[model samples]
Target: MAVVRSLRQYVEPVVFGAQMACSFFDTGLQMVVKQRSENATSPSDPHEDQNAIANFYMIFNMLTDFIPILPALILARIGDRGYRKVPIVVPLVGYSLSRALLLLVIWLEWRIEVMYVAPVIYGLCGGFSSYWAGVIALVSVSTSEEQRSLRIMRIELVYGIAGFLGSLASGHLFQLYTVGMKQGVLLASMSVALYVFCLLYATCVLQVSRITLERRESTSSGIITHNRQDRTIIALLFISGILYDVAVAGGVQILSVYVLNAPLEWSASEVGYGNAAGFLIFITSFLGMKFFTRFAVSDTSMIMIGMVSFMTGIYFMTFVTTTAMYFLARSVMLFALIPMPTIRSLLSKQVQGTSYGMTFICLQVSFTLASVATAPIYTKIYESTLDTYPGFVFTLSSIITFLSILPISVVGCRAAKQENYERIQGN
Candidate 1:
């Protein structure tokens, strides 16, 4: 019974399976968009195809980030009310349905624009914003404050490993179509099937408990005294997270389109390999977290280290014309995934355990809202500079990354002062 209960507590199954499915869906969608864009062009122009692809993704990403706001908020509220599985399971339903639509599009010879509905339904069902927040909230409640960051990173590690394996297989699976079936049919089918499994597992097999306030305050005086400082820290973390998200999102968005054009045009297999390289960062970041935690490094300092790692790597990304240079740039970003999860861990400490769902959702929603502006602006920058210097947007991303570091630096300084003050008080 004890072993069974322990096994039931594991959320990694859903995390791993869902991320694997998403990997297949991502590669499949990109290839489908590329195929449709090329087929629709009157003249065989790579530039036109590139623009079409970029335009499609810009709108696609915008709707994805925009449409989930209200639904995700409602779902988060519900999760905070104790039904944690609702947010996660409902989104899996959307995932299963949305991914199935891609299979239908491929199998039925439907127009590519039909694929846009996927995000609408996905968003309406609460999308990644609610689902991810719910997962984070669950993890936060289950672990102690001291171990929260490492546990969250472990989840990210599982997610990344799943993505890496799925990506390595996706390109070949996408190319495995027969005369009767179309390209990506098998991959999409597998994606839908995996999501259904996740949905069922989350609904039936996974066990979760609602977390209440960690401790009852003996007096309200301590709470009042710390409220202002806590709020400031929370605000700074939000700003830092938003800025970092924008930089990463913008650069990655452009990179997907960039790799398909000009000097380093990558094939489906190469695209999958490139994606795998990106997921490799999660492993490095998790290991870095462990090492730093062993040495008693502060979370804020870890976040700064990650921001600098990304800043340098993205700046280098501006010069990557060959695949070798691209991977080299990626190598420098080994800790890039550390900041966000660490930020979430810090945020969770600022509030009562019962509010974890709402707190996390707010952070996720902020990222979503910020991405609304980020998508189109980055898209325009990429489109405008496609001819002269396509790598310009990456440089712009590098600048934003540097700006993100400032807020985190302030957070680190504040934490240092608090630690010193506590030591002096103890003395």
Candidate 2:
């Protein structure tokens, strides 16, 4: 009985590990397919082929981001209604199916274009947006308001650690037994198995806290409203959060392809290493938050620091022609992870406990919409500049990240003014 209880306690971590493993596999597999597709098409020029394949990849991802919004919202609403596991379990099922489809694509040597269908299926089943919103809601309910940021960051830390480990091994897995079997087949198989385990574990072991649920129910109808100034601050935070996420997503989605084509052609192992470096952003960002909090730094200050770190790192990426430079650029952006979680934490504080699901849902919707626009635009810019400056996309990302800082700064100033006013009134 004790063993069983201990195992139950690990359900969330197990689910998170599975999800991260699948993501690593998907990332590596997509890179492999992109390269394979470019080789098979044999365009007149290598750069043109690269451009076309990257555009297709971005478009497919954009579709996935856009198509999942409605289903994700519906699933989040259902989760908020007390069926919390529905959103989590359904998305796992979708993820497993989509990963399986990639295995099929590998076995049959199908065209990469057919892979787009997998994401559509995954989106219809609720996708990452729904899965994440549910997880956030569950975590939010499990902790007090004072503990919320730390709790959420702890979850993200688990996610990052899992991603880092998975990424470190994924490249080796992809290249394993390359002589006896198809590349990435073994890795994809492992991904599918992990996701299947995730689905089963979540269904069988994860449970909602009845106390938290009851509290949420009692408090659902009593969310407090803010003054106009405060409302403006919240709105600016939301806008900045959306823009920051879009820039991050667009930059990351194309990073694999970017490294694969450039003067610094990285091998599968190198790709894994590069990805691990990116995952480290989560760990470092969490640590940075803790460090800042010890000094009682304001949330807005942390956010601004994160934005500047991201902008600086991305700008450096535009000049990266060597692997060392790439990793250095990533290292400089360790603080980049601060903004999103801080923004989410702030938003959570502003709303009623019961509304965490809806808040996350709205955030995901805005993120998706921004991604839909950003992906295609970045893809077009990257493709157009393939011959002259393939790294131009990074420059654009840096610029957009800089723009995100404006809204955040506005919110910060408003917050400072409010604090001063409150202190004066108290005197």
Candidate 3:
């Protein structure tokens, strides 16, 4: 807002437009992706299919994010004067139209075949945001390798706390006031309307920085090293973040279904409370870095440990037959949030300035993949569970959750050994 006031009139409008464009497109593509995923027949190898679809979203979302800059960033380096604006604007507009169309589906009540559209709409929105863009870019351009996750933790800390609060509020509202889909839709609509105002203000009010061609070429050239280690770490993060995505998208849809039917016998409101409880754990993680860092476990060790703990939490859900037990299990899982920031900071530290965008992109990619992978897996598992004891649905989720940790263990060990080797080399 301040930036706009100092520059030109209606700068806020551009900012707003940029924002609107992102919201519009992000929602749009997500809807289409999910619509397709949901309609596809449940595969025999549900896990494999889930993993594939999830990974596609993960990669596509990230590519839509950082990869969009290749032409502008790289071209600017090569003295392609006119190409600079192309990178920033083209995707923004593309994302916007996509979102608008996606929302239209929901508003129009698209047929049953388009059922998965909502989650995809939500996913695309995340892929095209200032929060996602600026923070990642900042870390890539300015931060060191070791500190990326720490900063990411800070970001996630804010994210966790805010998310936790929102979850609690939403849960409480649903539980307390009996808010359902109709109210939820009204609330969302109001939010979109407010967003319209924000878009106009930022675009019209914000000042733009004029860049010289020579400086643009020089900076873009020196911005990122394009190193192999950086790329490898990214690949690992991309894979790991999927764990989170699957837990999120699948958890919301499938867990709700499972919990509503299980021995826990939680009502809709209680289910909301359960989710809020998990977010509470996420929020507590903000304090984890302060107290837990002294274990002197490096970030990689912590990530490995966190993943194990996270999987353990999911595994415990399988055994839980009562709401009391569910509460107890989630409480213990609070410790797992610590690793989130630790990993995020690791990536942030590795890359500086705009390059953190690359790291951000990696994390987002993992997130998208998780969502895609879980879609079919959830449908298949749910179907199978119907044939067995319905309670076993939760149990199956636990197995998959814990099984996912094996990869993290391998990655963590690799990272830990890498740090030790670097230390030995330094000596």
Clashes of each: 0, 0, 72
Q: Estimate, for each residue in 346-423, the C-alpha lDDT of model 2 and write its tens digit.
A: 887677666778888899889998888878888888878877887888888898898899998888888899789879
TM-score of candidate 2 to 2 decimals: 0.93
After aligning candidate 3 to the native by TM-score, how far in Å is the CA of 191 from where it should be?
3.5
lDDT of 3 by residue, 344-374 (tens): 5555544533343445554654554455555
CA lDDT for candidate 2: 0.80
| Per-candidate local distance difference test | 0.89, 0.80, 0.47
Best by lDDT: 1
Ranking by lDDT: 1, 2, 3
- Segments in model 3 whose C-alpha atoms lie over 4 Å from true places: 1-135, 139-147, 171-186, 193-237, 243-252, 262-268, 339-341, 348-355, 391-427
1-427, model 1: which lDDT tens digit per residue?
Answer: 9998787777899999999999999999988888888899867576888899999999999999999999999999998777778889888988899999999988898998998899999999999998999899888777777788999999999999999999899988999988888888999999999999999999999987432223321122234355445688999999999999999999999999988877888888888998999999999999999999999999999999999999899999999999999999999999999999999999877786667789999999999999998899999988998889889999998899999999999988988898898899999
Cα-based RMSD of the predictions, in order? 2.2, 2.3, 8.6
Ranking by TM-score: 1, 2, 3
What TM-score do all the candidates reach, one by one? Answer: 0.96, 0.93, 0.61
Q: Is candidate 1 or candidate 3 better by TM-score?
A: 1
